[model samples]
Target: MDDDEVILSTPEEISAMAEAVKENLLPTKSRRLYEKSYEKFMSWRSEYKTTSFSENVLLAYFNSLIGTLKPSSMWVEYSKLKSMLNIHHRTDISQYAKLIAFLKRKSEGYKAKKAHTFSPDDLQKFIDNAPDYTYLLSKVAVILGIMGACRRQELHMLKIDHILDADNTLVVNIMNTKNRIDRTFTITGKYYKLVKKYMNLRPNTCTSQNFFVRYISGKCVAQNIGINAFGQMGKTMAAYLNLPNPELYTGHCFRRTSATLLVDAGGNIMDLKRHGGWKSTAVAEGYVDNSIQNKKKVSNLLMNSIEKTQPHNATTTYIPETELVPVIPAPESHQKNITPTLLPSETEPTQTPLLSQIQQDSDIPINTAASRNGNITPTPLPSDTETAQTPSLSQIIQQNSDIRINTAASRNGQTITISHNTIHNLHLHFHK
Candidate 1:
């Protein structure tokens, strides 16, 4: 239907509709909510006051909302609009329920888009190529996000005094956070130079303790710049870098990036949750989800563990001069025997799977009966078995348990004290 075809019912159609709704019995909050909703409704569909805004209109508006904001924001806005119809316009209870149901469906669709923040490398690129003079602010925002793992609003609320260096370590105290909870994050040595640089370059040196201040009038400092300022800065930097969507790199991107970087740097989800000030691990999980670097590291570690756990005679492709193997092939006989078991694997398990290998050489144990103790003792050298002067179990054990060492001179021109510690060190070296 053409928007022009809709007839205006009154001179002030929107206000008339709101006033009519106000006449109905409702609470102050309900009346206020009605007024706000009616105003917003009129802003979108001016004819909604006179003509019935059909379901098509609702769907159209919801569709238009796609990509305009986050799913959660869209849902909140939609809920507000729907609620206004019920509370202010006195929409029938049945119709109100139906409208909310429809909006819930729309919200799910919005959520299906899968919100994502910028990656570390991309964020770095944006910072590196960002406009001159803006580099300090752009990177500092990201650093604060990482160090404090705080949301944009909390970081924006930070004051100059937020950084306390009593113990020679810098820290950022996050106030006015999402959950209304306060927390502090330690600024470690890795970010020492960056924090110092930001402190030196930070604008608006105020007598008050606001960490982030802006310059407004002459030489005066403005207290607590808005979170939108950081977002604007991100957008401007994105534009200067010729990014696809400049608005996507808002201050929250820094927070998400911080969590992601920590995950890459061997930090755990619990640590991320604490640092990011998240009520639950869900948000932190999103920040680090599907991380290719971390996944590859985990895959490599699992593969290494599989190799370490394999039978010693497993025809392993070991690194030269070490017992560790890059790749190991199971014995042909074992593979043949296991064919039946492998045949049933039409569906692979979604979780991590263990790798199995069979011994291919005679130097290792195969049967469980022969695999006694955690220790594997190398047999006396046969003519065929080329043996290097390997360390002994006691020496290896001593080295693992104690620092005490006793050297024994070799009588056969090459005698060496092979301790348990030497073996442990060798194992650690090979694992690395």
Candidate 2:
């Protein structure tokens, strides 16, 4: 075959090439998990011959792991096994109704507990307790993992060239992330200083291009740190700090802590998604939901900021507690003498009465002589025909000389006169 020409392959070679391509399509971590899951299944199959790629066997296998493994781990194992079986048998095991129902029931009944995240105080304590130069790499790893919101694999895979200094901010270019998408985040404040310190102390004897290397006996031993080793450093730091359940704070705690801190600081969800390389807002929301105290703080801020105050002229009155009094029943004699005052009829006074002017004017003193005698002679009102024929006030007084103009105080404390002709003029003047 010529060097530039492609050779025709046999059937076995073509099949091998197809299998290799299919395996390469899966991520490295996922392919390893599938292989491990298949190995465990094969080991179980040796003891139980009836165990095959069936729903019953799979359910039984999951049930066996209930007490030993966590719900999340068991679910992952089941997924891996299902995927492996599907690829090998060319059948979709996830499509089985019974298996899907069983998985749903298991998920609903069993909730996996998450690990405790590191707070700012906890991180500070861990950094302060660094014993030697070798462990400073661990400190740098943790700081970068938290400040960049990077996973363990991403931290381990960071290369020296990925760190770019742009003025005061240091930019970290993260590759080989869980989502297989490249993301760049900036580090400023104290975290930038930490990265610079680690770089200054980096072992010159190590020929690795990777940013983080494994240091043994004050010398760099490996080109890059392993994922397990990076995670173990988190556990070690937690133990050194005497944190609660040190084993629970893994390398992933950095990512969780970073997301929680950003949200608590009022970071936008879209910005968080881009910063953390999250595929959906739901993931960012989940991280924020874990921050119960921050949620309560935000709720209190909203309640206080948007609170409405009562108007200055509001009718409602607040009685002081000390001035509250108890009521006592009146005696029978007092109760009988207390008569309810009748309210004036709605049709009684659409317009003010003519005598109301006398009551309003302080210059016009009320005559008390007739009121004291309790004799209020009702003044005869003018007939409607006489009212229409009546002239002005001066003319009425001039024409009616025999008319008795007696001033009697009415019940409403106003003086009334007994004159039929002058009544129409008073009514019109008062009403107008």
Clash count, predicted structure 2: 0
lDDT of 1 by residue, 1-432 (tens): 222224643356666665666456444435566566568666778644545666666666667766776667766666566556665444543354555675567566443333245666676676556443446555666667766766767766787666787565786677766676788877766455655665665554356566666533222344556778876665665566676876666666666667778888888878877877677767568776467887899899999998678663454443333333222332343233221222112232211111112122211221222212325432222133222255532234344433322222111122122223434544453355
Cα lDDT tens digits, model 2, 362-383, are 1222332332333444344233
TM-score of 2: 0.61
- Candidate 1: deviation at residue 199, Å? 3.3
Full-model lDDT, candidate 1 = 0.54
Candidate 2, residue 235: the lDDT equals 83
TM-score of 1: 0.50
Worst 10 residues of 2 by lDDT: 402-411
Deviation in Å, model 2, residue 87 alpha carbon: 1.6
